[model samples]
Structures are given as C-alpha cells and as structure tokens.
Target: GALVYQYPRRTICKSGTSMRMECQAVGFQATSVAWYRQSPQKTFELIALSTVNSAIKYEQNFTQEKFPISHPNLSFSSMTVLNAYLEDRGLYLCGAREAGDAEQFFGPGTRLTVL
Candidate 1:
C-alpha cells in the first residue's frame, strides 16, 4: 500500500514567523504532489503542485514567494509556510499521486497556529 507521511503534526508560531514541514511517499513513485491549506473555517485552498522534473505550478492566490516547495525526488517533498499570521493558521496537507492518476492520497496534515 502507498502512504504519505507528514511530520510535526502541529506547530505554533508568532504572527511573523515561519515553519517548515515535510512529506514522504512510501510504496509508490510520487510523480506529483499537491499542497493545500484548510483554514479554521473549514475551507480548503489548493496552494501548489510539484511534479518531478517539471516546473511547479501555483494556484491563483498562492505564489512561489509565499509558499515555496521543494521536490528533490520522486518519494519526498517539503514546503515552508513563510511569515506566519493569524490568517495563515490552518491545516496543511500534502497529497501525492502516481504518474497516471489524477487523484492523490493525502497525509493527515500539519496544523499550524499563529498568535
């Protein structure tokens, strides 16, 4: 079975800080990874997508400058939440997919809190 794992289930930071989280894919070659943010309001936003050997694509409200992603290999990826803020507090999820499937398997996610 394939699985994606994210570390440090939860984190708390100041209003102007940052946090880094990791995602690792096991039992599959994760060709693409999609990053998403779920706010306290329960709204989910697609942040970006990272594909192996291809340029990363960011969604409309997201940018490389704000949510930078690192996809060094087929099995692992990471992202940093820069400049933590009250509005930036949310659950960050990493979804991994194989080469052919448009669907992705998501990790439990890392919950972030800003104060």
Candidate 2:
C-alpha cells in the first residue's frame, strides 16, 4: 500500500511570483510521480510524469522550464511553478505509483491562489 502527502495544503502568492510544492510517498516505493493541475472548471490536466533515473516527460502545453521538477529518489518529489499567474491558479496534485503498478496514490493536492 502507498500513501502520498503534499504540502502546503493551500498557498497564496502575488502575481508573477513563484511557489514550490512537495510530495512524499510512504508505505511503498514510488517509482514514478505524475504531476497534474486541476483547473477551475474541474478538469484535470497532466503536467508531467517523472520516473526515477529517467527524463521527466511533460505534457503538450507544459514545459520543464516553467514547471521544473525534482525526483531524486523513490519516495520524494517536488515541483516549482515559475512566475505564478492567474492562469496558474489551481489545485496541483501528485500521484505516485510503484514500479509495475497500475494504481496511483494521490496526495491531498496543493491549492494555489494568485492575486
């Protein structure tokens, strides 16, 4: 079994600033971490997937330059939102999975608010 914990649960930042969020996996090895953003319209968008010892794969509209991720080991991961803006305000989630596992354990998500 696996469990993920993300923090800070909610955050507020001024426009044009940046914020970093972290995700941790417990009870199992997290071979991969998938970052996602849930939009205001309640749509989940895949941001990127980071696998241990492999390159991070970014989705179509996502770039590593904007959302740099760090997955240095099996149980920890973090990502930074560069230059926060209104459009970037959303709930950021990290789903971690073990190797060869189809089920992902999701964190409680980091809610971003830009003003």
Candidate 3:
C-alpha cells in the first residue's frame, strides 16, 4: 500500500527562524509529493508541486528550491522553511502519487505555528 507520513504532526517555532520538516513515502513508488499550507478558516494554499494555491503566492522555499519530489523508485522527501513568520503559520499537508495514477495519498500533515 502506498502511504505518505509526515513527522512531528505539529511544530512551534519562533518568528524569524528556520524549521525542518520531513516526509516519508512508503509501501510504493512515488513520482511526486506536494507540500501545502492550510490557512486558518481558509483553504489550503499552494506551497509547491503536485501541491499548493488559490490566491496564494508560494515562498521561495516552495517554488524555487522545490522540495524535490521522491523519484518513482524512491520513498522519501524533505523540506525546510527558513524565517517562519505569523503569516506562515498553518497546516502543512503532503500529497503523494505515482505516475499515471489518479489517486493521491495524503499524509496527516505537519501543523506549523510561528510565534
């Protein structure tokens, strides 16, 4: 079975700092995994590929550096966010899927709170 698991489930960091979040794709090959941020009382905003935005502008960490999607033959992926701010606080979801597959498996996600 294909599954994506994100650790920490939740995290709290000081404003103007960095935090590292990780995701593990298991049981099957993943061609891509998307990281998203769910805003408070708002829909998820695009953080990056296979991932995030409705009226959302992604930060560099998500758009430029692109937390590399795990190869279809691999099962792991990671991303780190630097300089977390109040606007950056939200639920981070990881969505995974394989090539030619329509179903996307989602991880429980890591919620971030910037102090």
Please give each candidate's TM-score: 0.95, 0.97, 0.78
Give the per-residue lDDT digits (tens) of candidate 3, residues 4-114: 899879999999887877777788666666677888999977676532112223456465343333323346666677777898788888777765355878889888899
Q: Which stretches of candidate 3 lie over 4 Å from their true place?
A: 50-62, 65-73
- Best prediction by TM-score: 2
- For model 1, name the residue pairs that clash: none
Q: In candidate 1, what are the lDDT values of residues 1-115, reduced to their tens digit?
A: 9899998799999888989999999988899999999998787799998899999999998999989999999999999988878989889999999974766898999999999
For model 2, what is the error of residue 87's alpha carbon versus the real structure, in angstroms, after optimal superposition? 0.2
Relative to the true structure, candidate 1 reaches a TM of 0.95
- Clash pairs for candidate 2: none
Ranking by TM-score: 2, 1, 3
Listing every candidate in turn, what is its Cα RMSD in Å to the true structure after a full C-alpha superposition? 1.1, 0.9, 5.4
99 Cα displacement, candidate 2 (Å): 2.1
Candidate number that wins on TM-score, 2 or 3: 2
Instruction: Please provide, for model 2 over 3-47, each residue's C-alpha lDDT reduced to its tens digit, 9 standing for 90 to 100.
Output: 899999999999999999999999988999999999898888999
At residue 111, give the lDDT of candidate 3. Answer: 89
Specify the highest-lDDT model's number.
Answer: 2
lDDT for model 2 comes to 0.95
